[model samples]
Target: MMNFEMPQFALAAPEIWLGVMVCVVLVADLFDRSGEARFAFWLTQLSLLAGVWLAFYTHWGDSGQTTFNGMVVSDSLAALLKAASAALAALTLAYSRDYLRDRGLLKGEFYLLALIATLGMFVMASASSLLVLYIGLELLSLSLYAMVALDRDNRVGSEAAMKYFILGALASGMLLYGMSMIYGATGSLLIGEIMLAASGGENALLLAFGMTFALVGVAFKFGAAPFHMWVPDVYQGAPTAVTAFLGSAPKIAALALFLRLLAEGLGDLQAQWQVMAIILAVGSLAAGNLFALVQTNFKRMLAYSTVSHIGFLFLGLVAGSEEGYSAALFYAISYGIMAAGAFGMIILLSHKGFEAEQIEDLNGLNDRHSGYALVMLLLMFSMTGIPGTVGFYAKWLVLQALVEAGLVWLAVLAVLFAVIGAFYYLRVLKAVYFERVENPQPLVSSRGPRVVVAANGALILLLGLFPDTLIALCRAAFGL
Candidate 1:
């Protein structure tokens, strides 16, 4: 008798490939113990890039395939977000290299954890089943929980980790309970099946309850208000590079999951959830902007800015138009670049033993390093939604969608809050230009980070001028 086993490698290729790369990074670091680990860092980063490309290359548009029996699914949406996340991961890796080394925190273990977290994001992006989503979410959360504590001797690091883990576990439990309720209600664990069952207005209460619970989890992951109590503390406590990574990439992946799970599968329940979404958006805008006004720490301020941006993102979804969806995706892409560029500049300006993370730290930058100041100025303006920048177009798209969606009043409020948001953004400008500091240190930048800042800043300007190209890409890529 002959027995045959199934070939599972193809189905698990992306995850397994990343795991192997993680091991390779560790081995490389172990063999080379001089602590000049830049080469290992590059290897790890390149592996992430390769893994991201490989996932897309191998998928070949297998959007319909239920790999691992409906666990991992891939499609246009997943591919877009995966590419975005991977790029952000790569950029952050490069941005953090010098900073981490300075802090004695640059290690293969650090990269390995980050890569694993990124891998989990992709998994979550493509999740087709509740079980799979939970697994993906936890994988990312667990890595982050440790990552927050990577600065072993720093007291704030331990505090940040404690807050993150406790809150993360709570959020996870809430999500699981909702998933269980959804399973009980529909008698199925597959998202596709549950969505199908929720259709035609059947099991409305269960679906609604599950959605509320799941949204809580999603909100916590993105650090939205009420659920956002941890963001500023965590951002302040963690090392700057880690905060930069946390600020930039994960939200895009999490937003994709939100779109897929809430807006796609649960599309039928739109009326029920839209109201809840609007409330969250408005509240986030109010709280984030209002509280950010008092922040002295630059990282904490950006953390609040992250929340306000989340609010803007939700505005797109609340529009509930194809155009609205397109707009939100564009915002995600632009925001990722903007956030990375902002933090990249911070890392460039900081020293080996000090964090240049206060607004005052930027004083005299224009006088000392005019070129770097120009990039920072552009990035800050982009964040402020000034014209001739991609951010203007991003905000335009979101505002336009709101108007088109008949949320004119909401749009008005958004614009008003945007004006309020500009206060903090312009405050950065004030320090760089108007305010003066004695004995300023000019920016120190390596080629990689310089190139990143220049390219991102130029892209912001170029895309604003040629909005059609990116707008068209975003339209096509939404594919919803």
Candidate 2:
């Protein structure tokens, strides 16, 4: 007789709940003849809220738990990142509501796709097996590809979708190949087993070669430089609503992917990945800052700005310690909040038939709506790493980690690039306060988006002033 035990499906309650809700909302939207997608929107928001609660409720234990034959894990890190991903997804939808409605792009598909993608992020956060991680990643990527092309009328959107799909497929293939190599070398697909195998040093050259390809895939997902050919074009061509979602929540998922595959599974190969991380960091900082300086498109400028921030995030990873991982997590969440607010500002100022894509679109913004101008001012200051903003502390933590690791020279180089990045952010402030527009239109947006954007700006300064709470949480997640 053979004995078998059932996997603990309760460990993945959040993902399971969200998956069920995706179906429920999809079916509910079919009955909504009003065309406003109100049913789908509210149901999706309810689902996310429930998902967050479930994630915390189910994963609040002190130690990590692996189930489904070690294919999924429930841990402090997964709990925190999963909750953050859900909250950020909700924020993205709140900011996107009016923008989509104005352009007649408000449909159930938008909400449905967002929920599905978020569920994918949740899965990625908890995956303990390489195969499970890849499945989650593909789910997220496919939803995003469709979301980018949601506006079927726009040729640019379709083009961006095609480019994203092709490049994304190539990256996925590389990642799969790398995973196969690692599996062949280690004779296992579970991350814990891979870590054990890597520590033995029996297949050093093969592991290193596999890691190279894996890193390429991770870099592409992060929109990091040398693999970031798709970022600017996608950001510029996609609808602002979609851009807002793309630039925010998926980042936390990317951070999860990096931590799980590189920091956790391949820690023994640090010497190899560290060198590669340095190269990526330097290239990203230089390319991102330099290119952003000359860009006239606000969305494209932020795309490069994202790349530069990724450079700083990489600095933390290079430390290869618990503190370094914690700092990177802190930076990832902070940047996600900042990015949401920055893009939300663009959506807030826009109305029917006038996409606020250009940098000069904000001319005389202070004269028109001082409140919104002040909000944008706070966001720009945060992005510039100004004192009394979260970005400052986020950067500070990364630099501190690098210095602690005795990489003082890299820290100094990062500071230089950060200084260069400040100029473009200041230019945005100048456009808001100093530049004059012929006739500035009144800012028109719903109360929900307005309130969310205001809260988003306030949170940045609040987190900066007292970052210890989030820092402690990050450290706790890593059991440091």
User: RMSD for each model, in Å, please?
Assistant: 2.4, 1.1
Candidate 1, backbone clash total: 0
Write down the TM-score for model 1.
0.94
**Candidate number achieving the greatest TM-score relative to the actual structure:** 2
Cα-lDDT of candidate 1:
0.82
* Span of 10 residues, lowest total lDDT, candidate 1: 4-13
Please, what is the whole-model Cα lDDT of each candidate in the order they appear?
Answer: 0.82, 0.91
**Model 2, span 1-480: residue lDDT tens:** 866779899998999999999999999999999889999999999999888888878886537789988999999899988988998899888888888988899999999999999999999999989999999999899999999998889999999999999999999998998999999889999999999999999888888889999999999999888998999999888998899999999999999999999999999999999999999888889989999999999999999999999888988998888989899999999999999999999998888999888999988999999999998999999988998999998899899999999999999999999999999999999999999988777776779988998899899989989988888888888997
TM-score against native, each model: 0.94, 0.98
Candidate 1 Cα deviation (angstroms), residue 448: 3.8
Worst 10 residues of 2 by lDDT: 56-65
